[model samples]
Target: MNNPTSGTPAPDGTAKPLQERCDNLMKRIDLLITIVDRGKGDKIVQALRDSRVTYNLSSVGYGASGLALVDMLGLTSTEKDIIISVVPEERASEILNILLYKFDLDKPDKGIAFILPISGVSGPIALKYISGLQQARP
Candidate 1:
């Protein structure tokens, strides 16, 4: 049998498969989801756009505060806007920091943001969208 990975053994002393090596060569992608008070999605999206982020989405939701005090204060069902953005892992931290300061997310009730590591992506369109490489392709 022939090994396409050049017999390079991963740290565990076992040769990694060709497919894994190919995947590792590709850029890593991540998803950033931010939940903010209603009417704030535009700000986040605009900031991302200004930073050259090409792909992002937003949806409406309601915050379910389970605290009795919140209920008494009529804060149980607060309108929320969920914004989701996909970017390469290399730029995820910088983008997150921009969001944090731009939206005052560090303050209480301001909003919340998280980054999820993507295992794999399929299709050239999706890859282009996430990788922000939409140049001419044959």
Candidate 2:
């Protein structure tokens, strides 16, 4: 019989599935977006999963309604989420877009998000763990 993936090995030979064994290392970034109906920054942190959050002067609202809404009182009370996770670049864009539309990000500053490059990754074996995690998740 013939081999589809070179199905059989050679004399005293070792045949392994051909996967790229490259030394080229890479980093990935994950983005997360959260939205709340005003005055709920504290609730945002409560809703997070697997994150150690530290916000920096994050504020949102229109006018004195600020954080509340004009039709409403006290700060409009609206907020958004922009989360970041660094992984392999191969998976970065996937996660970015996942948050973009998943969180209705196209509608102006309803929310903002982006990703950046990272350096000094260990190696592929270390990176493969992330891939394994993905499989285990869903």
* Reference-based lDDT, each prediction: 0.79, 0.41
Lowest lDDT sum, 10 consecutive residues, model 1, at: 1-10
Choose the strongest candidate by TM-score: 1
Residue-level lDDT of model 2, residues 21-99, one tens digit each, is 1212222423333443355434444433223222223345432323334536543434443333343456556655655
- Return the lDDT, model 2, position 63: 28
Which residue pairs show collisions in model 1?
Answer: none
Please provide, for model 1 over 11-31, each residue's C-alpha lDDT reduced to its tens digit, 9 standing for 90 to 100. Answer: 577666767654444657899
Candidate 1: list runs displaced more than 4 Å: 1-25, 135-138
Per-candidate alpha-carbon RMSD to the true structure: 8.0, 10.7
Evaluate model 2: give its lDDT: 0.41
